[model samples]
Target chain A: MNDTIGITALVPPELMYACGKRPLDVNNVVPVSSSSPSNKLCAWTAIWRDMILNGGLDIDSLVVVAGGDCHNALVDGQKAELSGMPTHYFFYPFDGDTDYLRSQLEKLVRFLGGIQDERMFSLISDLKAKGRALDELRVNDRARGSDVFSALISFSDLAGNPDIFGKTLDSVPRTDIRYSSRVALIGVPPIYPDFHETAEGFGLHVVYDELPYEFLRLGGSSLDSLASSYRDYSFAGPLKNRVRLIQDELLRRRVDGVIHYTQYACHHTLEDEIFRQHLDYPILTVQGDLPRPSTEQLKLRLEAFAEMLGVMS
Target chain B: MNIGLDVGSTTAKIVHVEEREVIFSKVVPSHHWTELIDDGQDDRCIVSTGYFRKKVPHCAAITEITAASLGARYHNPETQVIIDIGGQDTKVIDLRSNTFVINDKCSAGTGAFLELAAHYFDIPVGSLGRLHSLATKGAQLNNTCGVFAISEMISQLVSGYSMEEVIYGLHQAFALKISQMVPSADTVMLIGGTVRNTGIIDAINNVLDSKIEVPGAPQLVNALGAALYRERLDDGR
Candidate 1:
């Protein structure tokens, strides 16, 4: 029997599985969710918060990634805790202090009733390796970007079960991808549900999804290794480090352009200027306010971006 | 001859190009967009752009941003940035980086904002430029929001500012709102029908440090771009 644990942001799925718990990423449901949260700054946190409070999400306990990643979750997570949901606060060290992250992982393990199955670590490590292969398929144009993005974004919680998630990864259709330009999507994921598909419609092949790639990139066989790997989680640490990581990925991926998707009022929206200055690529910065189908306004930007990269280049 | 059709939020424009030169161009209300193409033209020879780019007859449809880029570059090969102030939205395209920002969420910096002010004054929107020239000193209207700025405009009217001065202030406010989206550039090309308003050009000049240049028949740039794109396709460039 596994307890379903809800996570507001990237909490180690391996640790949750090791603790005989299933980690469910709450933000995963947000893009497809129809929840219209009143009195909200960032819709991502607010919608998930409202869903947890309104009994929309089924979870035995909640873990809020408070220290690094999503500042709004700090307050929203407490709101859920105040409403009688058993919750734990997990922090990622902003300075990449492995010792501090190791301590935080220990606290998280205790919150999850301690690791009950140690073999779960290797299972997740293998799954992440598969995720990396799926990512490579798209980068090499052997797989459609939209199909690959749908699978890659789910790496956060591996769709709640590693075995089921592995099958899901296996089920992703492998087909040759054709596009006008290969682009990397940075910043937080777009709130629009059909964003990748829409980009594909406009002849832009999304080679990299930033945050989702982070999930597949960082993993380990044990708590000590996990601490070292996850501590360097780019979003958790300094901007310079994240920028350097993104630059390397962009180069490795050979992306023709970069699209930075910022959610309305998300703190990450502030990083757009820094990325534009540092990335040295043609960067298209787009913003989304609410979770809905991709708008004509967004499509215009994507189409224009494709044209700029394709026709102009 | 190649035809370029641009049907936007407020108006539809068409341009006829022959031998890389625009021979004729016309603008009409968006709903009457058919009038621009009613001269028995082949659909295969036409390229369409803007809001109704896909909804209209065309051989190839492109976004306004792309159209503006191609059009501005055709006019001035050294064009760095393009500030296209249309009826409903304003787009700032930087040709150097191939990046652009569109202000559609707010009406403050758009042509609709100016139209709202003109409606409040009970005057024709075209007369705003002439009226703006008459003001000696403009009043201050600081609100960035189009709705809130109207209230501020009324307050200025009540505070002894003349109608022309209030219009000047409104233009200044609009310029300030749009200036935020325009990146630092050596030369900025102003396009779209809204550039016909000299008041806006003056106000934008006052607010931005960059040298502003408006092409002849600024409104037809998108239409011309659409036509030019057709030529590009024919030449396979």
Candidate 2:
């Protein structure tokens, strides 16, 4: 149940790209791609597609994770209404206080009615344990070094069995690269495979992946407290404060530069420029569906940026 | 002597530079680069760029975006921004500092779009300038994609739109798509083979609200940049 929300809510924007919509809309983040009936889809989108393909849309109730500035709530709500499913909306507030979380949680409890009694707490504990275990295993995997793309796949979800995270970690080869400059890759999850490898090949070790390897477990002792932490997820904040968590990580991890990825025709690409203005480190802003100009062209640009940053001579 | 080959999607370009001066250049269909190079071509320092750079051997390969930027700067030192429309892609680069932005995944504001419009109207691409010269400022074309724009062109023609006027709209429509990419720019340098279309240069200037000066040989600019880069690497500047 927890993984269900995470997978749907943390939609890797590649699905948006595949839809052939200019400036990806959360509304078109539909379970099916009507615009492009046949574009290669990654695992995250594959799961979303398979769910719709296998009749996951036919449901008694719909939970809309209403997030983002536009279309997110309205689209999800419209989808539920269109399908004739009795619907509930969980608004991920862009800015919040503890009172906000408490009030929302209370309203949710009222909506669920008897869910507050006991089963909810047990479910929360199990989810908390499982999420933490996944994060721990993921951290261990990164420390030992796994293939960047494969690592992101393991981090996609708990893989239905959270215990497999450790076994999956052990299965991949580890590469411990001592580096000249450590960088953090931020923004929409990487949809391009060559980008990570290209960055590493150019001599910059991607020490931190802010969005892709995101294991967002809001820590707390109890379910009610957990709601407060969950509400504080940086993405739910105003644009200025949105990447506060990412900024903190950059400082803590000693990151030197940032490679910010974005897509064209995406209303969300606005976040890319905003992050550029916010970060103090040298940031290389890359936009579009694939390497701009061309793949080797983008690599040269990366190498030049890395060289400029003294990451490579 | 140094040779730079740009194997683009729609065409192949080669430029010969001697001591940083471009002495020779040519543009041909992409398939002919191999045959051109293999038979009677002076072997010199070789650098390549664009989509097909890997298919032919070269001393180094660079992305067209970066090459285009360096190319634009080489043509005009004051070039602060670059708008390059190629066979299949369009790019906007801000060179006041390092920045690269391209149209999402769609090939709407590219050379391919105009090629479709030219074929649809049965107007020689080279004669578009003459057609635009005769046209009064025309109707706005909302669809910029190749397929839909062709359909839109047919509708305009059937709806009794003037042939020259509709051709002008195609240029303006391509310009409009370019405007949306960066939204606005100061001192934007327009390059790529499509820049030879004088109507596009005029429409883009109107859309950007700034006059854009085209390089002497616009198609040769990217290949020239790669050639100069080889000189820079050898000379260590």
Candidate 3:
């Protein structure tokens, strides 16, 4: 039986699979999680940390994306490690240094017991190509944003099984989506599980989900290629690159507006102003603190944004 | 004739418009909203907005942000921004960018903050503006949190500041809390029932760089906007 490895943030699932380990993106379960962390800055890290500490998740080891991801996860991940989960800290290069990322990947490979089946890398890369196609379906208006979002977001760890995950992606219904405005959701995904559906309810169809797209866009069939591809993970690098990448996607998606969903106390929340200054689109910024269903306040903003784009524009 | 019904958190407002001109208007407590439509008007003729927009009978329901925009544009075509201080939340809408920021998590800049002060002073909320006019200068209130501001208010009173002066300080605190949300603009229109408080308007003028304008019956703008929306639907333009 393959050992299940827990990940705090975005780590190369292909490498984990090559090392004969099932990578579980812990953040995947955060939105639907009911646990209330006693102390937390960002609910994403805190809930997952508490879940691991409380024996909620079954995993052999944990990988903490300490650097270039969520700053809060560093301390929270340590709490889980202290509670006895075997842990490894992985850092993405802030300068887009492929050599540095390759070294980090090598260390991560060793932590996962080294590559046992190198073919797993190519297999996962092929699956990611399918993920990109699923993303394109929504961009082309051939799929509902909610359905596409669910499938695209899962690209992080492919639901821990390539075969089952492939079936899940294929199962996504294809249908033309009609909306009052096309909006791009940038920054971390909303903590509310039903955020995409709630936005669709207000006639604002999300055509681009930033982080989830990152999951599918960066993958390779070799360690050297993987390092180079994931090194350009926009979120880990400079804001200007992320901004440029987001601007490109927004244009490609023909978004009428941008919704920057910032997590409460997450450092990325500070980047809201920069995106507002750079992104040349109507932008509505919303913050979430806990994982739950979409709140009325959020619905009001979505409804108002849709009205503004549909009526005023 | 078209009817606009705005049932907000604190109050319910209804407006009647005919040929682009307001014919009649009325304000009632939110619970007494039924009184506004007791005349057996057709739901198709009514456009509803505010927190209870969908809950109320309406042919079309719109958000207060859109209502405020359309309503403010009717008052001033070139209106750039709008600061709506409702009972539970305050929304700063930048019409130029077609974006808005709502401060709902905290009550500091909202009408409820002022209501807390009024309840503490045992005075009617309406008289706050009149009392604000009596103060020569306000006592200092640096805290922007609604709960903490109450302590600051009590501190001001303990230091021999008059009740009117404390009210003046509270208004200043409220305006400062709201000013953080408003972006740079040439003109900002203030709306929502709370705008009827001249104290808040005065503090906003002191704090904001932009020229502040309040339409007649500022509280009825959302209702007016809802009515205007009905007209737009009729024209189908």
Candidate 4:
């Protein structure tokens, strides 16, 4: 690929595997500078900028999501673009009952030319296929009862590794483990996938979540569906709808318990009290910041919750 | 003539009055203070308060929110409660006879939240209220903290809510947060810079589910109250 077409991934998330271009978080290449320009900015923005400037991420092409700290990720994309890199921003809209991801994958594939389209599509198809294989793996282990614990323990391999994601899923037995406790992983997006794997390892299954995969998604046919509905609704109406979605998910999932992951100085996520009255299940909150949590700490928390579920039963 | 100046985090306001007749009043950009205060124009007494009050050049008196509350209550004894939200902080003042009590800490439901939301929406700070009022819908802006609210706003918008609704949701979330900080009271009058934004008042009304009365030029209520304090001290002198 020409250097001009070289890509610098600015926190693209899962779409990276679907897009055929290289994936690199800006923070991984840059160092965080003093936040004089961002003092007026929110903590998430400040942290993201600091990561890009300080983390020393390397990239030539930039892709950014439409919402979250990623909204401003485009600013970094703009800078990279100015430096001669090609950039694109992908939007995800909410109109339940449609597959936004598959369409986004198609747009991403078309943008990159046909070179990587097959590989990206194949990866997605592979994951879906593995989802079934994973079900089969779990069925066999559950039939064996005690080995179900081993299958669950093997699930932690999925975090940040797509191959592991597939392998772990394929490793679980399809049959429901008898007396297998259920827990809900609620925290950072990364932690959710990893913790879900760990839950399986502990002979407990996480049936619901508050992670990005469980909630915020971009599913629709057109680019218009990717943007916010600012032009479509009034101030309070759209917001009320957003709240109702969260409420609906929580109620619909019917998970056994919730574990809230909180970031320090993150003002918005900590508003547990605001949503506390809306919840019915027992909630366990854990606080941490990233480069990801220490493995030992995560293991302990996961196991403790699993034990708690076992006791409740 | 007496003057009161309130310096907030994002903007500043000066109120000049002579014997109850209002003179000149202006809301100036916060960082451009030197342009307005040059030459020390007058010998009259001037009192100041709020976040940027200390940044003001050569002033006669500087009082805390507590004293300002008393001063405002003294001028308008009908005032039973004070709801003041500045550019970066918020205060709920409870009046009991001659004294006023203020909230203990600065977090949640303050101007800081609005400032955060403005940046989140990529909108100018002063235009927040207008934008908020224009929003026809609302997203549940997770007002858990300033940091989280930004992320939550993005997530909410991604999920199909509008930016205006997200911004308005934040305002409502913030108003609700501040209202909970206040103890029960009646005939409440809102003060401080944020009170100038009718959208904020509307959000507060929804939060409190009651009517709130604000003085004309609500931002000056603090400065006017400070002027009242200067008058009280002069009487004692």
Please, what is the whole-model Cα lDDT of each candidate in the order they appear? 0.92, 0.61, 0.92, 0.52
Candidate 4, B6: how far from true, in Å?
Answer: 2.5
| Candidate 1 residue pairs that clash | none
Give the worst 10-residue stretch by lDDT in candidate 4 chain B. B97-106
**Tens digit of lDDT per residue, candidate 4, span B1-237?**
777776666666676667865687777777765554455686766776555555565344444454356445645777666777766556555554222223323455777677767766677777877878888878886655767778888898889987778878888888877877565666677877677667788888887744478777777776666555566556652
Ten residues in a row with the worst lDDT in model 1 chain A? Answer: A152-161
Candidate 1 per-residue C-alpha lDDT over B1-237 given as tens digits, one digit per residue, 9 for 90 to 100: 888899999999999889889999998999999988786745456889999999988889988988999899999999999999999999999999888899999999999999999999999999999999999989999847999999999999999999999999999999999999999999999999999999999999999999899999999999999988886787785
Candidate 4: tens digits of C-alpha lDDT, residues A1-313: 3211222222222334434454544332112233333442333344444444443344454555443334444565465456555666654443421255345545655665534333443454455444434333433333332233333322211233556656665554456454355445444332222444555676655544343322113222222332232122111123345445556655654556666655544543645554444555555555444434235445544554554344322
Model 3 CA lDDT for position A1: 86
* Model 3: how far residue B49 lies from native, Å: 0.5
Across A194-288, the per-residue lDDT of candidate 3 in tens digits comes to 99999999888899999999998898878899998999999889999999999999988899999999999999999999999999999999999
**Stretches of candidate 2 above 4 Å error?**
A1-7, A10-64, A67-89, A100-157, A160-174, A178-183, A191-205, A212-217, A248-270, A276-313, B39-44, B158-161, B232-237
Highest DockQ model number: 3
* Model 3 stretches with alpha carbons more than 4 Å out: none
TM-score of 2: 0.74
With a 3 Å backbone cut-off (N, CA, C), the pairs that clash in candidate 3 are none
Q: Residue A248 in candidate 3 has what lDDT? A: 93
- B1-237: candidate 2 lDDT, tens digit per residue: 877889988788998888767888888988887754775655555788877876787887766765786678778888777888887888777665455566635656888777777887676777887888899767567755757877787788888888888888888888888888763455888888888889889888878865576888888778887776686567663
Off by over 4 Å in 1: none
**Ranking of candidates on TM-score, top first:** 1, 3, 2, 4
Docking class of 4: incorrect
**Local accuracy of candidate 3 as per-residue lDDT tens digits, B1-237:** 888899999999999999889999999999999999998645456899999999988889999998988899999999999999999999999998999999999999999999999999999999999999999999999746998899989998999999999999999989999999999999999999999999999999999999999999999999999999987797784
* Number of the candidate with higher DockQ, 2 or 3: 3
